[model samples]
Target chain A: MFGKGRFVGIISSIIAVVVAILVGMVFALISGGNIIDTFKAIYMGSFGTQMGLASTINNAVPLIFTGLAVALPFRAGLFNIGGAGQMYMGAIGAVLIGLYVNLPSVIEIPLAVALGALFGMMWGILPGYLKAKFGVHEVINTIMMNYISIYFVRYLVSNGPLNGVMGTARTVVIHKSAFFPILWNYPIKPVSISIVVAVILCAFYYWLLESTKIGFEIKAVGYNPKAAEYSGISVNKNIITAMALGGIAAGLAGACFTLGEMHFVSNDFPVEMAFTGIAVSLLGRNNPYGVIPAAFLFAALQASNLQLQLFAHVPKDVVNIIQGVVIMFVALDRLITYLLTRRKGGAKGIGNT
Target chain B: MEILNTTLLNQTIVAATPLILASLGGLYSERTGVVNIGLEGMMLAGAFFAVWGDYITGSPWVGVLFAVGIGMGLGLIHAVLTVTFKSDHIISGTAINIFSLGLTGYLLLVLFHTHGSTREPVTQLPYINFTALERIPVVGKFINEVFFNHTPIAYIALGLVILTWFLIYKTPLGLHMRAVGEYPEAADNMGINVNRIKYFGVIMSGALAGMAGAQLSIGVLTQFVQGMSSGRGFIALAAMIFGKWKPFGAMWASLLFGFGTALASNLQGTNVAIPNQFFLMVPFILTMVVLAGIVGKSIPPAADGKPYEKENK
Candidate 1:
């Protein structure tokens, strides 16, 4: 079902890679660092050793879920910027359940996780509903929802019944039963149980997009809602479904942060993961599978940024520069295709913007 | 009662200055079809740059110009991505925001060696004096302090609302801009350069939004701090929607929000004894209430997010 556009897409990808590397070089020079040393530090930071690689992958866990959250909606031609908000809500949900409910390990774990997904689903569904029913833009609503989600968490932890007994804007530590099993006990090895969950999510997402009717309908609606409606597909329903599923993905990301990394709900927990997921999804070309590598690449950059700072005196702001370039590249895909097609003197470009 | 009334009126106008300027900025972009969600980022950058410029130059006027210039530069980046390359507008806008946060934070760390930078005894913009007219009594005190006591830019913001209203409804360029936003292909076929119009709209949006930031740092707060723009840009977006995309109407919408903000802040020391956080939440809660109530009927430009492409079929 994939289009012939993949060929041009791959070629443009190569061009993007070259352009990005060059941009990196230019940035390195501007920052008074040698290009060679920066690349070396980046390598050591991400995958020079087994421990490094694991840390990189560990960081990728949330990115995968968050990326899918965004990419799934894009498939339905919806922009779900509320992933940050949804993800935070999910974290709050899971943390609340994990902290309060005392149940068997298996039961509590799954239940807490489910709460996260449910929270995210609810958050995602609102914007989807607004778009489907009222034609209010999901982009604007989701963005707004993120603020609400963030503040709601603050309010809950600061003054609500859910506030930690210590009077801080954080929840009580989740029960041992609620914790995701850590992969290792080593101090330097930061990898956790969330990686396994993230991988499972990746598989589920692949199946959802490629092997399901809902997924097919989502793509159809995204490509052309009018035609899909004409052809008996309920475009509104599919759009809502896509947004809900996206929310679930984001919710899972939030749960991973709480259950795997923090083990408690704190105000500083999300740490821009929701926003980073948008960048990861965009960089990954909106492919569910592509999110894995894209997330790792970004997470590794984030993970290794401190080391880069130590090695080259190249500040961590350079990572922001790199990410900014990557986003610009991905967003400029249609432009890239146009450039490539023009270079070949073709009668047409690969397709949509 | 008269004294209290005059004081209340003064507070309202003082509170409305930033909102008025920023909302006008929103009007400029959204009316022309490119949703300027990055107005907050642009404003934040402007605030930071204005502080940086003023700190180094010791002239607030130079700082204001510096802010306007920086705002335009940021707008140019948005225009290139959204208008020319046809990137996802929300994503691109979010990137600008993230970038502004990180870039300014990083720059502050590097230059000031601090997270938030405030000048020592920062020089605030000089308030325009109408003291000579104050002898006219209760009405004169109200008029002088409330209306005429603001910085020069506040007056400029009032002018901007009127100017923007005219531009959107009267001028040929404004007509073309609205046409491009409402129906780009139709506008394109009519020989209007949709991309050019979008570029202009975004650039102009940035300039005014930047001025809003300048007002915050130079006029009101007298210093720049990280995340200082806070949610003001989004608040302006809410105002733009509440106003139903008319410039003068947006000014009124902004004033309503500004009134809520002033009320929340003013009640801090009084016996009403509400929590400060509640005060902070007032504008945002009002925004949500406004958006939930009004967004359904507010129609954005027809071709708002759809990046125009030349003939392909």
Candidate 2:
């Protein structure tokens, strides 16, 4: 679902996505790529076959989780750039249990996931606390936390106490007890029940943000802090809550990647995926409903990396540019609002966050 | 021991040169009320283009010029988005960063026909060595090694610090820039062109940042490396804050962080008990600590990051 919204809002969002894709295509054309072949390759790579569709879902599963992580804070008008660190913490938490704990499948599975979220929540809460208490900006703080967490993980997997075999740069294989149940037994990477988890979380996200009072307070705080304070909302409290909740979502993303897909933790996890969540959130207009399709599109485009390179001779990095373009288009929210609103009250700075 | 300190100090200034340049660039944009987190991206694009330009032209000067132009281009985009489209400053900066990352990586493949890095090293900027002074005793040797022996950009960085201080504090234009940042309405009432000044500040930042990136590729490394800027731009941001947004303050802060980086690099592979990762994290951790400590007490420009919208009567 694209969310129930004003017609202009829906049109603008769609136009943004289209314009971004077209921009990517233009780049491809300029780089001597055959547009017809590139299009065919992209189509066939992500959606052409049963395996392709399954792969898209499998890949989109983690993104859906991370998309929620970014979009939730974005709703509260905070940019949680620390998703990479939060995800790393989550994966580490899940892996530590998956290797060290010996328990029944059901109990250990949920326990690992919960602890993963808890770890991520802790990591996220620190910056949120600092921003709320002090005037400390979260973007730089979160970025610092990401480097620290990434390096911390590097230490754990490479030479620290949690390192598996010598020079392997990975933790030991996670126990079967923590494995996500297979929904489809694909040969390369199985489609897990985590897809179901991802969907349910998206649904829950929609309900939490759209229908709940907590979400109302967060939005109010985001819309105007001083005004929100007058309306009996504690800005500090909402800031912490939003970041903590976003942490939980990002943590789940890591759990899905680790336990459901990789089945073991490694030092070289794709932290760029966390950055992609920003693109996904912006493209989704920071809505849970829109995030599903937005995540699917990004996952599909990413899956085309191989085919595009093989047939069209286009580097898959074009996808990254495409995502960046989407963000650029989305960043024109004020201009779009200005045009749509018939120039009422001109654009304001809104807020720094 | 004196020799060792001299070596460390030399390394510190060399290492800090890029940060010094980038933070000064940030000083300009911020002084005009635009928050530029995209310094990282602008620097990155500059680094890629620097190598590309030199590889094509057989001259590092051309590469430095290309970097300046590209950096300014990106800065222009930032200005357009924040000033013209009235987009949120941070979001636009984030977009610039991502866009620059992909563009650089992609262009690296297309132009260089190489992945990740270039095989051909470009000509490096000449190091200003006082070879004759090396003949003298300790004081001459110290003077030669400590202050004089560096790439030209390092000297330029130092020069710019003094220049920026004079420009920002002494010049009428600098007062106008600060006025625009502090209160656009007042500046506009005084007949200052707020948007034009902001564009100039932001574009100037891009040029300086781009030059900083060139320093990384051509001045320091002599070859372009993927992700070479590697958070230096953000480190510069931290320096800007730590320096209280003053040019001299930021230069000192940059040197402090650069010293930490030099120590980390120097300590690598040593028998020191600390993990290399922890050593690598010192500057970042320090940045966070600095932000947490300084933010409440240290104030930014009142209207910094707020897009100036002309009042419609």
Clashing pairs in 1: none
lDDT of 1 by residue, A35-132 (tens): 77888788888888676687787778888999989889988887777888889988987998788898997898889889999999999998888777
What is the lDDT of every predicted structure here? 0.78, 0.87
lDDT of 2 by residue, B44-100 (tens): 999988888898999889999999999999999999999887788888888988888
Candidate with the greatest TM-score versus the true structure:
2
Measured against the true structure, the TM-scores of the candidates, in listed sequence, are 0.91, 0.97
lDDT of 2 by residue, A1-353 (tens): 33323455556678778998898888888777988999998888899977677778887987888888888887777988889999999999899889999799989999999999998899889989998998677888888899899999999899898888897899888888999889999788689999898899889988998799988987888778889999789999999999998899989889878889998888889888888888887777787877888899989988888888888888777988988888887888766766776765543333446
Q: What is the C-alpha lDDT profile of model 1 across B87-137, one tens digit per residue?
A: 777767777776676667666655555656664535677889888888997
True contacts kept of 2: 0.68
Q: Which ten residues in a row have the lowest lDDT in candidate 1 chain B?
A: B1-10
Off by over 4 Å in 1: A1-4, A10-28, A49-51, A165-167, A343-353, B1-15, B116-122, B185-191, B267-279, B310-313
